[model samples]
Target: MNYAPENSESAAAAVSAIRQMIETGKLPADGRLPTERELAAELGCGRRTVRRVLDTLEAEGLIWRKQGKGTFAGQPPDPTGALAAEIAPDADPLVVMEARVCIEPALAELCALRATGEDVQRLRKLAQRASHPMDADTAELWDGALHRAIARIAGNRVMLTAFALLDEVRMGADWQEQRHRARTPETMALYETQHRKIVDAIERRDGAAAFDAMRAHLEALSDNLRTSIRTLDE
Candidate 1:
């Protein structure tokens, strides 16, 4: 509420404020802004000052006002929509499962071939931490880490880095939170048992067995996605 711009801010702070709002994604492009009066109140400026600022913004091509409809950001900040956009209901969980099916079983096979003491130890640590006895929900963090650990054990930097992309997708779409909503105690127990089985196979250095176990995990996950989608369709 301190309308005083720091000395670093140039004389035309209002216009700068508007640009900052757009840049930081507080005001999404194609989204309407508040009324001039409301903006004035928030900015601690007079309505006339707000009008002057709006005129300057229009002149600079930073924004366009539609009279009664308010203003819109001239340039869409992020085409990727990291901070905006809805999760489309039809976005396929199958695609994620498909990637896991293709990527993870091979990852396990490589781990079986390439695992050093450090690699196996890291995988075991991740699995243990995720499956810590306190709460199963806490296991979900380790769940993601376990996959990344497997990829790391594969010794492929490119494959390991896919975890970052998947993490970004999960954040943007809120994947784990959404999936958690669909889970029951029976389901949680089922997944925990399956996860431990895969880890055990990897620890046993059974490459083919580990691969099969990993594939089965993805198959089950895909089935769950299918069932969930059917319920949604219903």
Candidate 2:
């Protein structure tokens, strides 16, 4: 606030104040900023000047805004969200699962072959989190994290992008509804076992075993989803 003179109405002064806030961690990275009105009041500037400052920060990759999500400090989120939303309507859960089954096993195999010591340790932590999630939301979150870790360890950029697209499409509400229906206590237990086996195989550097374990896990998921869809039709 002291970056600007008291009662100053200058855009330059407002920008300096906001930038200093970010630099000093008064505005934490990825944290939402004060509203334009609040910032304007604090800086003794008009909202127009505050708006200009925000626009300048965003253009410099220092902050970003979503339509209704408010301006946030730090670089903009990846462009994949926009792309995912665009293609989600056309995606079917079953087809997406099929794509995952095709891609993930190969990634798992590659991960077993190429993963560094650090990657294996991180994968173990992610697998542990997935194994004992507190609820459905956290289960999904950690499971996704576990799989994405394997994909990253696989070190195939093209395949990882493909995996990411399928992963994003599966987050659609319809897909979530179907997956939730398929998920039960028994299925969750089975998934945990399968996850451990996949991670174990990777830790052992057994490429074939990792490939087989991941494929089996995906097959189980596919079968469960198929059953869920059929039961709904019935």
Q: What TM-score would you give candidate 2 relative to the actual structure?
A: 0.68
Candidate 1 lDDT: 0.69
Q: Per-residue error at 10 for model 1, in Å?
A: 23
Best by lDDT: 2
lDDT of 2 by residue, 196-232 (tens): 8998999899999999999999999999999999999
Q: Which lDDT value does model 2 have at 219?
A: 99
Window of ten residues with lowest summed lDDT in model 1: 82-91
Which window of 10 residues has the lowest lDDT sum in candidate 2? 1-10
Q: Estimate, for each residue in 1-234, the C-alpha lDDT of model 1 and write its tens digit.
A: 334443323326766776787667786546666677887777766666677787887788777776566788774344235322333333445666676788889888877777877777787777677655455466666777888778778888777666445444554564664466556566666767777777777777888988998888778767776777678778
The runs of at least 3 residues in candidate 2 whose Cα sits more than 4 Å from the true structure, single-residue gaps closed, are 1-56, 59-79
RMSD of model 1 against the true structure: 11.0
Candidate 2 local lDDT, residue 187 = 96
Give the Cα lDDT of each candidate.
Answer: 0.69, 0.86
